[model samples]
Target: MSFARYVEQTDPPRPPRETLPTMYDLPSENPEEPGLPDEFHDFQPELLRITFQPPTHLPEQVFSASDMNLYYNVRYPNWYKRPDWFGAVGVPKLYEGRDLRLSYVIWQEGVSPFVVVELLSPGTEEEDLGRTKRRNDQPPTKWQVYEQILRIPYYVIFSRYTERLQVFILQAGHYQELNLSESKVWMPDIALGLGLWQGEYAGIHRLWLRWYDAKGNWISTEAEQERQRAEQERQRAEQERQRAEQERQRAERLAERLKALGINPDDDL
Candidate 1:
């Protein structure tokens, strides 16, 4: 029977959980249908993962993944969704507190992602924006997985082509589109904000999605922080050299004055 017909004929209105196929009932991936992520997809997610820092969580307690299979439903052990980038605050960085994870299984981790980001691609734009419809008996679309099933707190979509950013926050059991006038969205619980930054990342100069602190400062990657520290040191050294030059000139003037008085400057020295 069609899913619509099944719903209407049932004596009691059945919840989606009862009528729809859960994550476990679906396959994780299709061998024939492979994902081909472009350059923007590769670089943008790395930037987000590197800059993800939750103020209240330790490095060991916060986990972030890019293009990793995220297994969501307990009943559908093999069913999973792969997010472009996703972060969880309360989970250990290592799987089972020992080895790195091959995939993020929600049932084992006991923590849903705090935030998810999708770098819009030509192929997945409609589903990413929740504009696509799911067929009956098919696994839920990416939108359904993140919004209805996982209930991720923050959902972000960025398009490098237009340099546009969209943010959604879950409220009252539904995702609400947020108006980002400044092209940024702040999450107080995580003490961080996400925004489009125009700067060089990975030697590529373009607008990219990055994290910002609560005080409105862009969180720096390790390489960026190192470069900044090196620049500061160079400035300090230049200032010191200028001070030394001034001191030497003053000493030379004093020596010349002593010589004019027929007194050896060496004696004073």
Candidate 2:
């Protein structure tokens, strides 16, 4: 059956899980929180989906990496920020295989994402870049979370408004800025790479982050590849038409030469 038909047949129902206590293990909160910007709510979920891989286990929710819980008690009393995207290459598939979490708890899971990406915004930009100091009483800056706490190998930030992209690689226990050329940046650790490109994803025509092949080529989107194939077919048809026209012109010229020599062009026939 079609997905739409299946959903139409079933009734809407609540998930069979209770709301966990609103423990402030991290500084995040519902959109109702005061001082939270309006735009944050609009893009937070999309940012998460774009940054992380599709959940390996759950076919329903796209951002199941949150269940991995990368910040259970890594830095107690300090808040955790779930990045827009993250990847933990060598981590185990599941922890105990039950009691799925709503967020990553690093203490419970020994691994941290090899790469962490933060989507840039006015509120989070300063903290994301680590330019703002962590007030003596407040939680660690976004910079601290990726560089010191998680010790992630690669940290990336992309600004939607300005189309700016930045990369930071851990060197000597701290992050040092990596250079970008046009739209690509190199991350040696992942063996692959990351970059921002102009393309359509999920029907949205905007700049989006994507992985690259070993040769530093932007992996083409499925839609783009299909469009390319169609274009190639069109070009091949045009070439065939041109070749047929050329052959016809040559036949006409040969007939004219036979007439000029007073020879019957179709005598043999």
lDDT of 2 at 23: 28
**Tens digit of lDDT per residue, candidate 2, span 94-193?**
4334444455656545567777777776767788788988665566666776776678888878777787888888998889987666666655554556
Once fitted onto the true fold, the runs of candidate 1 whose alpha carbons sit more than 4 angstroms away are 1-30
Candidate 1 C-alpha lDDT tens digits along 1-269: 64334434643543354454433444555576666568787888889989998888899999998887888765545567788899999889987788877778786688999999988888889989999887766676788788877889999998888888999999976789998779999899988999989899989998889999988999999998999999999999999999999999999999899899999988844
Alpha-carbon runs more than 4 Å astray in model 2: 1-72, 75-78, 93-100, 220-269
Q: Rate the local accuracy (lDDT) of all candidates.
A: 0.83, 0.61
Error of 2 at 74 (Å): 3.9
Estimate the TM-score for candidate 1: 0.87
Clashes of each: 1, 12
